[model samples]
Target: EYLHFNLFKENKDTFEANTIITRLLGLRTGASSVTFAGTKDKRGVTVQRACLRCVDHERLATVNQRLQGIRLGTFAYAKEPLRLGQLKGNRFTIIVRQIQPTAAAATLAGDALRAALQKRVIDEFAEKGFVNYFGMQRFGTRDIGTHQAGILMLAGQWQETINLIMAPKSGESATITAARAQWAEHHDAKAALAMGFSSLYGSAERALLQWYARHPELRHDPHAALFSALPRNLRTMYLHAYQSWIWNQIVSIRLDRYGPTARKGDLVLVDPAVDDVDDELVSAVDAASAAPKEDADAVPRVAVRALTAEEAAQTSMFDVVVPKPGWNVTYPDFLLPHYQSLMAQHQLDPLDMRRKWHECSLPGDYRHVLGRPRDVTVAFQRYTDPQRPLVPTDLDQITEAPTKFRAAPAPFQALPDVGPYDALILGFTLGTSQYATVALREIVEAD
Candidate 1:
């Protein structure tokens, strides 16, 4: 049986949290034993369900004490280990700091003004919902977007793809950044490995450097050998991110062209019963290696179909979807021209995503055009200190221990008088793949 636990983490990414647990449980057993439903942001406090194979509750409970910013509890046994896209949704309690008054609200003062602004935002969001454009986080905050690397990969540019992946970034350590800069300028793999990388962040770069070090001359399967050094998910993520980039732009075009309402030739799910539709992609490496099977049950449970004008008239924005752009998926007839035009700009053929290297071959998926949060609740509060805790975490509620987990303050009540800063405590539940940041953007009208 899999030992399931509720993982509460503050300011740590999913990979960091999982790595800590893997060591405590014994890493020799393998990192694959630890699994989670989804990845959460590294900026804030997040609580999610996770499962570990071949671990006991007592040993798992010990992890809570060993960890500083992480806590594991609510232990139990399950028949299956947690997999990606396993959760129905995520419940978020976000504190939007430094809430500024709009030009219209400049004249109004204190709680009266707060009430007016809150009601306006709540009412509009409840009715219209937000555009389901993928957040900027998906593309990454870098000079070269992740999708650019995928484009190079698909076009059969191995050296360029590797160089792009090894490019220096703003926040990395000086030593590693210098090493990357040297590699970018000199293209010397041996020199990069000689510099040494001890930080976990440089793990992928180190692996690639090491690979290139051994094979000074790339003669056979160089691309496959280099790519195989990275994790399967990381390798596949480049292609997926490329799809996301296209999807985001197309969704914006759809909104601008036809507005939020459903239109003729828009795609919808073939099986409306499947609400938790997720992009469950197999690694191209795995797909290429495994023998082709003819199992009828292996077909996707949720397929898409375009709507007729008559059917479109009866459809809601919620039912409408846009293709992620793959060989298998169908694009809307009206938007096909726009899609082709966009692909042409990148020197890619939209109809054919297949490449000589199997890793670049993509089978696309679909995403909803609009995302609306469920049971959304918002409140405003005035605070003198920005460092104060805004919301209590899951660990704060259950345990009374004197650890940092017990230090969280309760949600601040709205006051009549104005303070130094205004804060918005927003709570909502979003379905799988829906971004909480996107929902907030609709209310705040911020980029």
Candidate 2:
């Protein structure tokens, strides 16, 4: 049996936190033994369900005592393991502080006017939804982004791909950056592994370097072998990020040409029972690729069709669909030309996306061009100390901590105190693959 626990973390990414827990439990298999519904942001406190297979409960009790930034609670045994995108949806309580308007929006700067504008935005988003563009976080902060590595992988530039993955970036410590620079200059796997990089962010590089050190024979041409040595999920992330980039470009074009309104050749989901579109319901079927072979039957099969000009008139923004760029997906007739042009810029052919590497071969999937947030609520508050938290986290409520409602020092609190700053607390539920950051972008009108 597996043990399920509610994981609460502040200022830690889901992957990094899971790695620490894995090591603490002495799980030699590492990340393969742990599972979570979805990844959460590292900047804020987030509560989510996670599971570890065949774990000793006694060891889990020590985690709370040992870990500083993480908390584990409400443990239970379950028959099944938690998989990515397995949850119905995520409930978020996000706090946006130091509210200020842009030059364009500065004319209406009073509290009442700002409140009215926010209300209008929330109401419009609730009804028609905002553009479901991939957030900036999907691509890494480096000049050579994750999607660029994906492009290189697909194009069979293995050396270039590995170089991109191991390249050093800004904001890293001198030692870590030096290690990466050493690898770049010498390509000496044994030398790089000897230096050691046990940091949370250095796991991928360490794994790849270790593989090369063990198999010195493959060091001369270690692209395919090196790529294969890494975990499946990590490889999949690169391809997914590339697909997301293409989807973002295509969706932006579609929205610019046809806002909210469905076009003649736009694609929409069709259920056998309901001949027309099901605009009100968001299905949990977009995560087909994320599911394992054992869970194939659990994924629901969704059918889609191109809308006729007459049928298009009856549909709403939720009815429009965009292809995630793969060999298996069908692009909307109206957007096919745009997809071809965009793919050509990267020397890729969207018509035939098959690659020799299984990780690079994307089968494609469909996602709604727009996503609506459910059970949404917005409230404004005035706070004296910016270091204090405006919303209570799940751990606070679970532990019944007296400080739940009181002002406490928090991590990563950098909001300057321009006295009497307004804090916007938003409570909403969003389905899997939907970005809360993107939703916030719509509310704040941020670039």
Candidate 3:
């Protein structure tokens, strides 16, 4: 049986949210039984659907009551589990705050000028879609070393991966910073093992340390042992992050080659159910590889095929799809040079990506070259600082008012005077695997 819940999470990642719910339900099957369409941002308030197996109403209620920073809005039983990329799209209501007029227009009139600028930006986005670049969140915020570690892992450099994972970053906690410093200074298995036992070290780091402590003789071939010690999800993530980085580079190159449009040799993705034998084989292989590890009963598949001259004529109606490099994945002839150059730059061969560990192997996937937001609407409003009095100009009069006036202030206080700052409220919807943050970047031009 499948159970669905409306998850409202604030400042929490999807993994942490799932972990909380799994613990609250007291399900022996653990987190693997729960599934979600996609992950939401950790720093924002997001509402999305999630599913679990063999959960009842009572347990769900207990979960809602026990969990903090997450509230269940709706609950129902489903005949099937919610698989990844199952959603049609997500609706976003984002408030862009601290907006200021451009320097050229700063001297112009008050709110009107800011509002016009905001509208112009929104209109530009509506006319031309934003660059579909992967946001920085895909990499670690503090370290930004996941892709580097992934590169090392793929190259069979185990010690380097360990170093990258345990290295000290600028804003780490005191304990972590000190532990990493000790590891960096000594570079000894025994010392690192001792440090990893500390409460500050995460499970993956501790696992590596424990492996080193257990098998000191295998120091020369530590890559295999050290990598095997990490959790399966983490190992998979390392490879996935590397693939994402490669895809990002390729997308940048594609934009340079074909400016905002597709050509005859370009590739486009369509529904996998197309009556093509090659597409079916790709779907089957991806499903077989991913289903067991991800506990996904059903996997969604799409076909990535090169556009013919006839198809390219209507390219604007479809999205250009690029392959996430893998051992078995095929690429169009036109893009082969670019792919080869990128792989050469990283000193990697496609054959080397094949791994004995199935979880770490790439199952081959496709991502669109351009992401366009749908049903976009924007509104502008004057922002006011709530801290000071509603009218800073009238502060002296309020302070000097009579004792009776001070004793009982007016119930309906005047609205705060509008400040120079303006806020932009943007509403839009994006399909699965698309990021709202990426779309917002086109307007704000911030990282």
Best by TM-score: 2
lDDT of each: 0.71, 0.72, 0.65
Q: Model 3: residues >4 Å from true position, as ranges?
A: 23-30, 63-68, 103-111, 181-203, 206-231, 270-288, 291-314, 350-353, 386-420
Query: Pairing residues by index, what is the TM-score of model 3?
Result: 0.74
> Clashing residue pairs, candidate 2?
none
Q: By lDDT, is 1 or 3 better?
A: 1
Tens-digit lDDT string for candidate 1 (290-338): 3244321233434778888899899998888788877657889989888
Clashes of 2: 0
Clashes per candidate, residues 3 or more apart or on different chains: 0, 0, 0
In model 1, the Cα lDDT at residue 403 comes to 46
- How far off is residue 435 in model 1, in Å? 0.8
Best-to-worst order by lDDT is 2, 1, 3
What are the RMSD figures for all models against the true structure?
4.3, 4.9, 9.0
Measure candidate 1: CA RMSD: 4.3
Candidate 1 Cα lDDT to native: 0.71
TM-score of every model versus the real structure: 0.84, 0.86, 0.74
Best lDDT goes to which candidate?
A: 2
CA RMSD (A), model 3: 9.0
lDDT of 2 by residue, 83-136 (tens): 875677778888878777666566665576557656765777676566777777
